[model samples]
Target: KLVVNPEKIKSLKDVKGKKIATPQLGNTQDVAFLNWISEQGWKVDAESGKGDVSVVRTDNKITPDAYKSGSIDGAWVPEPTASKLVSEGAKVLLDEADLWPDKKFVITNVIVRQDFLKEHPEAVEAVLRASVRTNRWIEDNPEKAKAAANAQLKTDTGKALPSDVLDPAWQSIQVTDDPLAATLDTEADHAVEAGLLEKPDLTGIYDLTPLNKVLKAEGEPEVDDAGLGVE
Candidate 1:
């Protein structure tokens, strides 16, 4: 989520020459923001984060405070940091999902070592089954699932988000078993455009067969790997 203080910044163009905070330089949100800057024909050093806009590398723990203290004009951060900022009178200027096709992109992905997958294919299949089932349950019962997730978050972090912040943030995310392979490729391209990464040859980077098998057995459609899957 990209949020701005409406009093300080009314639009994306207003971000130029302003101080903006990202969790860290070269992190996913940082890369995405840098890429957007490149698209805008603005200049910024990917490593130093110095350019048209002052890209401050701030921790998520302090980003909301930074905004409240008027140190940063805005932030490009993930939830619940984004939600936390919203609670402090920030306006959501953009949701990164809306920038992509189908309003879907990969925020999280499941990975396993090649050796592990090769040795324990059945284990992988079982995990995928559980993942698919969990996604289905979440979709079928969003409010209950949200509460369950908040409970787990509270257990881990010792605090649960208030309803005002949690509701909108939860609504923005779409949980699914699909890895959205094409979006991963696009993100890599974004990193390259932002000068944070060399163009990577990502062929065979995905092995969705186990997930697809689970979906098929459940009478669901298989997801495409965007030509980046193993043969």
Candidate 2:
């Protein structure tokens, strides 16, 4: 999501010549933001993060502080940071989800070393089963899941998101067993367009059989790997 200080910036075009921040120069959100800028006919040196709009590569830990202090006008970030900025009075200018088909995209994915998978297929299946069950539980009981996730976040980070931030951030995310492979391919293309990556040969990049097996056992439809699945 792109969260902006509404009092300072009202629209996408208004962002030109303003200061904006991304977590890091070559990270996923940074690449996406750079690609969007190029699409707008705005010039930004992908490597230097300079040109029309100053792209400040701020660390996520201090991004909210930067925004609060008016050091940056807006940010392209993922949740809970996006929600944290909202708590600080930032308004979401873009959802990113809205830009994709069906409003679904990959934010996180699970990958195991090829050797580990080959030697421990059963272990992989067990993990997939747990993943499927956990996703279903979250879907069936969203409020409780949110609380549980907040508890874990607090344990890990020494702070829990306040309800105002947690509620919307949790709502924006989707938990599912599917890897949403097509969107992963699209994201790679976005990075390429932003000059962050060369055209990647993604053949055999997925081994979804284990995930599909678990899904079928749960009476769910299988997910496609966008023709990049192991044959």
| TM-score (C-alpha, index-matched) for candidate 2 | 0.97
The lDDT, on a scale of 0 to 1, for candidate 1 is 0.91
- For candidate 2, write residues 1-231 as lDDT tens digits: 989999988999998988889999888788788878988999988888999988999998999999999999999999989999999999999988888899988878889999999999999999989999999899999999999999999999999889998999999999877788898898889888877889998879999999999899999888889988987
Q: What would the per-residue lDDT of candidate 1 be over residues 130-205, giving only the tens digit for each residue?
A: 9999999999999999999999989999998899889988988789888999999999999988888899999999
Task: Give the poorly placed runs of model 2, Cα more than 4 Å off.
Answer: none
Count of clashing pairs, candidate 1: 0
Q: Quote the positional error of residue 215 for candidate 1 in Å.
A: 0.8
- Collision count for each candidate, in order: 0, 0
Looking at model 2, report the run of 10 residues with the lowest lDDT sum: 26-35
lDDT for every model?
0.91, 0.91
Which residue runs does candidate 1 get wrong by more than 4 Å?
none
TM match of model 1 to true structure: 0.97
